[model samples]
Target: MGRRTLVAVARPDGRYDCRIAHWGVGADPIAQSRPLGTGLTASAARTVIDATYDQLVVLDGAVRTYVVCWLDPTLSDLDDVVLARTADPDAFRRWWVERKDEACRALDSDGCDPATVRRALLTSLRNRASSVHCLDDASFLRGDR
Candidate 1:
C-alpha cells in the first residue's frame, strides 16, 4: 500500500497517531496498518507529517484550527470547556497512551490487549465529543475539507 497523505497527531512520547483523512471514513486509525511506514520513530514520521501539513496547508493555521486536546486519563468530565483551544498532539498522546496503559493495568487479565483499551478510550471520548471536531486523528482532523 502506498503511503498517502494523512493528518497525523503527535504523542507526548514523540510517537505519531496517524489516520486516513478522506472518503468520509474519518476517525479510522491507521497506525496498525503499517503500510505508510508510520512505525518509524518520531523524527522520521514527524518530518513526513510536518512536511505534509506545512506544504498542503498553512502549518500554524492548520494547527490552530484543528486542535486535538487529550483530556486527563482520570477525567470523568468531557466538557468542551475543559478542552484546549490549540493543537497539542504531544499532550494528547501522553494522556491518551497513559490512560490506555492504566486501563490495561487495571484489567489484570492474562491477555489484556492495550490496543483494545485504547479503542475503548477513543469510543468513549468520541461519544463525549460528538458535537465538536476533536481532530484526534487524520480522519477526525479536518479543516480544509
Candidate 2:
C-alpha cells in the first residue's frame, strides 16, 4: 500500500464517491479527498479508480484485502487467506473445503453444464476475482475450485 491511494464508498442513493486521499493527517502533499467523482455507479466508479489508481480496496464495513495485480511467477502456490489468517489452520481448511464443496454441489444442481464449467474453471485458474466467483461457477464440475 502507498501513503496515498484512491478509495470509494457507496452512498445511500446507490452511487459511489471516489477520492484520492491519504490515510495520514495534517494535509499531506500526496493527495486530498477532492471528490474524484460523485453520483457514479459502481461500475463507473471502478473504471475511474482503475484509470486513476494502481490499487483499490473494499472498505465498506471492514478493512478488506487490497488489489494484487502482479506476483512473482516463481512462487509455488499462493496462500489461501483463510488458511493464512486463521489460528487453527487445519480446522479452518477442513471447514473451508467442506463449505466450498457444498456450494459447488448446489451450483451443480442449478443446471450448470460441463463445457461451461470447464471454461469457467480455466478462466478462474488464469485470473480470478477476490470473491472467487468464476471458480465458484466451475467448482462442481471437477470437485475443486
Candidate 3:
C-alpha cells in the first residue's frame, strides 16, 4: 500500500463512521456518513470497522475495473469481480463486443453456453435497478456519463 486509506472508522463511543480518507493526509472528505451501530464493545466496533472497510474496497474495485474496461482494451483479466460491477445490459454488451473473442474462448473452456449466459447476465442487470424512474437508461450505458 502506498498510503493508508480509511473508509470506515471505529469511534471510541461505540459507533462507526464511514468516510473517504485523503491519501497520506488525516482528513477525510466524506460524501455521507451514518452511525454503524450503538452500544457496541471495543472489539465489536473493531469488527464492524474491518468489515465495512472490506466492503468499500470491493465496491470501489469493481467500479474502477468496469470503467477501465469501457475506456481501454483490457491488459488485465476482467474477472467476476470486475464483471459484477457492470449492472447495465447495454454497457455490458458493449464490453462483451470489445472482448468477444476472449470471452468466448473463456466460456468454451469453462463448458458454459455463451448464449445462455449472455441472456442470464442481461436479465440480472435489468433486475438490479429501475432505469425508468432512477435515471435515463442511456446514461447507464454511456460510460462517460
Candidate 4:
C-alpha cells in the first residue's frame, strides 16, 4: 500500500488557526490551528508539534487562499507544505478529492468526501501526536512527482 495522507484546513487570521474539515476518524476534540511565531513559545510549539499530523491545510479567509503542510517521515523531518494561490473553487475541490482518494487507499479505508476525509485526517494526526511517518507533498501536488 502507499503512504497515508491527512489534511487540515485553516482560515487566515494573520495566524494559522486551521479547522479540521475532514479527519479519517471520529469527531470529538475537533481540530485547531497553531500560530507560527517566536521560539519563546517552544512549549506552545511543542504542543502543536506534539499534535502534528501527516499533512495540514490552511485557508486564508481574508485572501480566500489555501496552504498545505506535511511531515514526510521519509525525509527525516517535517518540511514546509505550500500550495499555489488559486481562486477557482472547482480546481481546489478537485484537488482535494484526488488527494483524499489517495489517502484513503493508503490507509486501506473507503474513500470519502473531501470534507469528511479532511476532518478524519486531522483527527488521526492528533491521535498520532507526531509528524507523518513518510509523505511526499511534491508528489502529491504534481500527481506524478
Best by TM-score: 2
The TM-score obtained by model 3 is: 0.22
Better of 3 and 4 by lDDT: 4
1-145 per-residue lDDT for model 4 (tens digits)? 1212232223232223323323322232134322344322212322342213423332222223222333222223443223333344335435544654566564445434545544565544444322222232222221222
Task: Give the least accurate 10-residue stretch of model 4, judged by summed lDDT.
Answer: 136-145
Q: Is candidate 1 or candidate 2 better by TM-score?
A: 2
- Candidate 4 positional error at 70, Å: 5.0
lDDT, model 3 = 0.33
Extract clashing residue pairs from model 3. Answer: none
> What count of clashes does model 2 give?
0
After the best TM-score superposition of candidate 4, give how far the Cα of residue 18 lies from its true spot, in angstroms.
4.4
RMSD of each: 14.5, 13.6, 15.6, 13.6
Off by over 4 Å in 2: 1-4, 22-32, 68-145
- lDDT against the true structure, per candidate, is 0.37, 0.39, 0.33, 0.33
Q: Which ten residues in a row have the lowest lDDT in candidate 1?
A: 51-60
List residue ranges in candidate 1 displaced over 4 A: 1-61, 64-86, 110-119, 127-145
Q: 2 or 3, which is superior by lDDT?
A: 2
